[model samples]
Target: MVDVSAITYDALRVAAEHVLAKVREGEELGTEDIFILYLGTIVNELRDVRSEVARLEDKIDKTSQRIDETNKRIDELAKSLSARIDDTNKRMDETAKSLSARIDETNKRIDETNRRIDEVVKSLSARVDDLAKRIDALQTTLLEIQKLLIELVRSRQ
Candidate 1:
C-alpha cells in the first residue's frame, strides 16, 4: 500500500536502539546503588569507631578516678602508720627513761651495800687485833710463873 517493508524495518531499528539505551541506563543505576551502599557502610563504620572511642575515653576517666582514690587511700594509710610509729617511739622513749632511772637506783643501792660491807670488815679486823694482843700478854705471865717455881725448887735442894 505505502511501502510497508521500509517502514517496518525503520521501526524495528528504533526499538532496538531504545532497548539498548534502557539497558545502559539500568547499568548506571546499578552502579549508583552500589556506590550509595558503600558510602552507607563507611558511615556506619565511622559511627562505630566514634562510639568505641567515647567508651574508651569514659573508661580512661573512670580508671584515672580510681587511681586517684587509691593514691589518696595510700596517703591516708601512710599518715596513719606514721602517727602510730611516732606514738610507739614516744612510748619507747619513756620506757627507756624509766629503765635508765631504775638502773641508776640499782647502782646506788649496790654502792651503799658495798660501803656497809667495808665498814663491817674494818670492825672485824679491829676485833681480831685486840684478841691477838690479849693472847700475847697471857703467854708472858705464864713464863714468869714458871721461872719463879724453878728458883724455889733449887733453893730446897
Candidate 2:
C-alpha cells in the first residue's frame, strides 16, 4: 500500500528506466515492479484530470462574476429611468397647474368686460328715451303756432 500522491516524477522515471534495462538484459520482471509501473501510470492520468478540472472551475468563476456585474448595471439603469420618469411627471403637473391658473385669470377678465358693456348699453338706452320725449314736445308747440297764424289771416281779409 504505497501512497500514490507521495510518489514523485523523478522516482517514477528512475523505476521505469531500471525496468527497461532489466528487460533489455533478458531479465524477468517481478510482480512488485509491474505494480509500481501501473500505479505511476494511474497517478499521471489523475494529475491531468485534476488540472483540466481546475481550468474549468476558473472559467466558471469568471463567467459568474461577469453575470453579477451585468445585473448590477441593469439595476442601476432601472433606477435612473425611474427617477427620470418621476421628474417628468412633476414637471407636467406644474405646467398643468400654470395653464389652469392662466385660464382662470382670462375668464375673470372676460366677465369684467361683459359687465362694463352691460352698463354702457343701459346708459345709452336711457339717453335715447329722453331725446324722444323732447322731440314730441317740440312738434306740439309748432302745430299750435301754425293754427294761430291761419286764424289771423282769415280775420284780416
Candidate 3:
C-alpha cells in the first residue's frame, strides 16, 4: 500500500506540471497576437502617409503648369503692346509732317498778298502826281484868255 501511494503522488505532480506548461503557452500566444496587432497599425499609418505625399506631388505639378501658361500669356501681351506703340509713333510723325507742310503753304500765300498790296499803293501814288500837274496847266491857260478879252473890249470903246 505505501508503494502504491508514492506512485500515485508522483503521477499527480506530473499532471500539475503539464497543466502549468499549457497555461504558459497560452499567455505567449496572447502576447504574439498583441504584437501582430501593433504591427498592422503601423503599416496602415505608413500607407496613409505615402498616399498623402502622392497627392501633394500631383498638386505641385499642376501649379507649375499653370505658372508656365501665365508666363506665356504675359510675353504675348508685351509683344502686342510694343507693336501698338510703334504704330502710334508712326502716326504722330505723319501728323507732324502734314502740319509743317500746311504752315509753309500759308506763309507763301501771306507773302504774295503783301507784295500785291505794295504794288497797288505805288500805282495810286503815281496817279495822284499826274493829276496835280494837269491842274497847274489848266490854270495858266485860263489867265491868258482873260487878258485877251479885256484888251479887245477897251479898243472897241
User: How many clashes in each structure?
Assistant: 0, 0, 0
C-alpha TM-score for every candidate: 0.67, 0.55, 0.51
lDDT of 2 by residue, 1-157 (tens): 8776466766877887888788789999999788877877887898899999999999999999999999999999999999999999999999999999999999999999999999999998888888888888778887887888889899898
Ranking by TM-score, best first? 1, 2, 3
Q: Which segments of model 3 are wrong by more than 4 Å?
A: 1-43, 125-157
- Candidate 3 residue-wise lDDT, 1-157, digit = tens: 3698567546655654555566667744355455454554565576699799999999999999999999999999999999999999999999999999999999999999989988988888788778777877778777777778788888798
**Which residue pairs show backbone clashes in model 3?**
none
**Shift of residue 86 alpha carbon in model 3, Å:** 0.4
Q: For each candidate, what is the lDDT?
A: 0.81, 0.88, 0.77
- RMSD of candidate 3 to true structure, Å: 18.1
In model 1, which regions exceed 4 Å deviation?
1-39, 143-157
